[model samples]
Target: MIPPGPKAEKLAEEARTRMLNEVDERRDPHTNATVGQLLDRYMKTLDVGRSTHGMYAKYLEKHVRPFVGRLKAGALDGETLDSLYAELRRCRIHCTDRRGVDHRTPRPDECDERCRSHVCMGLSSTTIRHIHFILRGVYEKGVRWRWVARNPVFDVDAPRAAKPDPRPPTAAEAVRIVDAAWEDPDWACSYGSR
Candidate 1:
């Protein structure tokens, strides 16, 4: 609903250009941009390896973007992020094929295991940590660009991944046990105890 004037014509032309272009530069760069908008900008500015960028993109697509996509970058609060992490910690991923087909097929033997419930497909703490890094990077950019006052990532704590405990090497210790089992005159001679 424009009043049909030179200003309206200029805005319409800009909108048309934005639609034709692959990049969405419709929003002004200096404004308090939305989380989704900033993510796109951050992704476009990545100078890392393709594989690394792909992984970051995957993390954004799979978790971070889906949750906070529409929220304004400046509007992100600690409580909202903490709540998102809580949900992510308990979230179960539905494994799918390249064709987007669900991988969970029900079998009689698997019924007892709740095969359809995806109990074992939950996102790991380490993966959630990765998502955190992606968000942190985006917000860091926001901070640098003066889009936001400061990064909100520092305000929340992500869950710690457990380190597996190391056990003594029983197989290597077995060789020592065998050596001790055969204490002989050769051992004494070797040490010049004869």
Candidate 2:
């Protein structure tokens, strides 16, 4: 209280602003709702076709709910979403450790030599992007409805689509294919070639 300077005034103003923001957030309803609840609410209000709605529910259940469902709708941030995306990229199945198991074997008696050890395959970038899309939609709705003040997903980046790696036939391969096709007179007639 004894400080008397421009800097002291600035510090006091910042403190007051921070306190006010905290109070506002505490009073927000979004802060009281979990991400899972938000997703459920969004799903219920969605107006897409039956199949599209089913697909959305499937994506949310398989990719999103287990990761951030328990988080507060208002508490999500770029860092939290980024971590979730990274985890999904590392393993689509969300493997806890290197422990191997044959997922095909429904029972111990059904175990066979064909059942191989578990392999971790990361989620496709496209699917992850879809998940991100669903999240963005949900959060945008929350912001529009005033349930949340901002959409945290707006700060996060969705995974980019993978580039196509095309492998055209080499010169020799093209020649061999032409020779093979020419050997079949029926193929020439089918193509209306003399």
TM-score of each model, paired residue for residue: 0.60, 0.72
Q: Alpha-carbon error at 111 in model 2, in Å?
A: 1.2
Best by lDDT: 2
Worst 10-residue lDDT window, candidate 1: 94-103
TM-score of 2: 0.72
The residue pairs that clash in candidate 1, if any, are none
Question: Taking the tens digit of each residue's C-alpha lDDT, what string does model 2 give over 18-114?
Answer: 8788668653453588889899999999999999899899989977889898988888899999999998888887888687875565667566788
Alpha-carbon lDDT of model 2: 0.85
* Residue-by-residue lDDT tens digits, candidate 1, 113-152: 3333334355788888888888888889987776776688
Stretches of candidate 2 above 4 Å error?
Answer: 1-30, 105-109, 166-194
Per-residue error (Å), model 1, residue 14: 43
Q: For every model in order, what is the number of clashing pairs?
A: 0, 0
Give candidate 1's error at residue 66 in angstroms. 1.5
Question: Which stretches in model 1 have alpha-carbon errors above 4 Å?
Answer: 1-30, 94-115, 171-194
